[model samples]
Target: MIETPASIVADRKSVYGLRTYISLFSSAGIGCYGFKLEGFQCIASVELLEKRLKIQRYNNKCTLDSGYICGDMTQEETHNAILREYDLWHNAFGIKELDVLIATPPCQGMSVANHKKGNELKRNSLVVESITMVKRLKPRFFIFENVRAFLRSICTDVDGVDKSIESAIDSNLSGDYNILYKVVNFKDYGCPSSRTRTLVIGVRKDQLEVTPYDIFPDKQPEKTLRETIGHL
Candidate 1:
């Protein structure tokens, strides 16, 4: 059954000592809902569309009004807003650092489903923004999720050199983070649908107790769509 906002609020666990996260390109806030379920509190979320951001607000995705930001990631305004909000949230909790950064950049340009994939779309370069934020925020852990083609997709890096997304990530963050880039189907990870996605996960070097492999989901028996929703 679909959960309502009130139900979610009632069921919400106290996050006093839990990890904190901020999301970039958080469309409708569904993707980060999983993180909330995992006991992480959202410090802030950025979505370009006001309509989509409203949905996030309606769902109470972030505890503070300032936490829901509507702005373009490419702009300096958005970056500053994120930093300001993160600092306020971080200071309020007296946390040493942000625990996680979850980014799901627009994937239309890199998705195999896009038949018109020819020259790289401008949106593809948005991955660079995700990379830039990771470097700036230096979260203890970070996650990037997109279509399976994302790794091979080309994007201009911070240095303005064109490179595959995989190479860009490796060149920029490998030195500071123990990173893992992998493509896996969600069905293998216990999701109902057979959705394949590329996941890039990073653990800051100082966070030595755990590696990306330690946090990656273990494979599980696949579930069919019929089995998942047939009752409805």
Candidate 2:
């Protein structure tokens, strides 16, 4: 269920109630938003970094209701364990389906900062792992976020030549899901950060609506970094 502005404000207390099952993968930004929405109550979360796991537990007060799995998602055993632990296969939540799945795979390979180096090779396979998890979880909605440079990364085609990132996503999720991609700047969304991110939202074809992009604000007030900084 996509949340509306009025509902976000009026039903803030129960906003998470609408989402009984949520899976967050290698998510740091979501953790920030989770605090605001009390998203620690999500059914399951997975993080590979120990420091990040510590922070998640501390911030969430080690909540027992939600399960946190710490391991590399590239491993099949880890992936299978997450499925069994979350009971996603059995639909134990009684909703008959998982609500949402969010993933922000390591972006170093797709980041401009790694230019000229072979960091791309290091992080290339993680993208496939992320997509694999999405295919297995089969959530109602899935969101993937990454750096703008990701749009430039090339994927090897059958001809052994490079193809655009859009082509890569199209080949991976075309018939199984309908994907909407957008490049957004935080400043344009009234956030102080000049941070720009590429967000890809995937909805099963059966769930297509009149406007898949209508969920976000069309226009937002601009905000400056000064307005967001605190003085010491």
Candidate 3:
């Protein structure tokens, strides 16, 4: 069934008291929809394309106009805009910290399905922008999602040194956060179709009660391709 913005908003009426979150590279709101459904209130979301942002807005991913940002993640202006929205949330909610940050950077360069996979693909470096935000905003929990090869992919770090994406994340955040990286099939986690992806989860050091292992869900019964899409 297709879900309308009104339906989503009505169903999520109780979410105002839940943990607040923000999204980066939130293309059409697909990646963050699960978070929203789980009662995480998305206060701000950024997408580079206006068309995609329009879809997100229609879905009510962020109800506030200031929270729906459409701009280049690599640009300083875009970063400032996101930060401004974060500040607004702090003031509106009377809180100094964000609950969660969900970022799914473009995976074309890191995906095995891409025939043109190489360091020449500038999109691969966009993960650095996500990492930069973690440093600046310091959300209590952060999630980075991408293709299974994300950690193995090479990208220039904040220090301008070529390093694996895993190393860059560790070098930048391991000190302040307890992080874990895992590769899993979405089918094993109750998704209808099979999808292999990498997930990097980080919990701020101060959030000692919850570890990455506690956040990652246990495996579920696998679903077959035919079982998932046979009707179509």
In terms of TM-score, the best-performing candidate is 1
What's model 1's overall lDDT? 0.86
**What's the distance in Å from true for residue 78, model 2?**
1.9
lDDT of 1 at 181: 91
- Is candidate 1 or 3 superior in lDDT? 1
Error of 1 at 35 (Å): 0.9
Report the lDDT of model 1 for residue 5. 34
Per-residue error (Å), model 2, residue 124: 2.5
Query: Please, what are the lDDT tens digits per residue for candidate 1 over residues 1-232?
Result: 2232342254334545556799999999988798877767788899999999999888888867788999999999999999998787556555568889999999988877888876765688898899999999999999999999999988988998988989999999999999999999999977898899999999999987999999998899998888778899
Better of 2 and 3 by TM-score: 3
- What is the Å distance of residue 146 in model 3 from its true position? 0.7
The 10-residue segment of model 2 with minimum total lDDT is 1-10
| TM-score rank order | 1, 3, 2
lDDT of 2 by residue, 77-137 (tens): 7787667755742353334565567777777777767667674643644555656666777
Q: How well is each residue in 121-171 modelled by candidate 3, as lDDT tens digits?
A: 478789999999999999999999999899988888889888899999999
- Go through the candidates in order and give the C-alpha RMSD of each one to the true structure: 4.9, 6.1, 4.8
Clashes of 3: 0
The candidate scoring highest on lDDT is 1
Off by over 4 Å in 3: 1-18, 118-121, 223-232
Q: Of the pair 1 and 3, which is ahead by TM-score?
A: 1
Candidates 1 and 2 compared by lDDT, better number: 1
- Looking at candidate 2, what is the lDDT of residue 188? 84
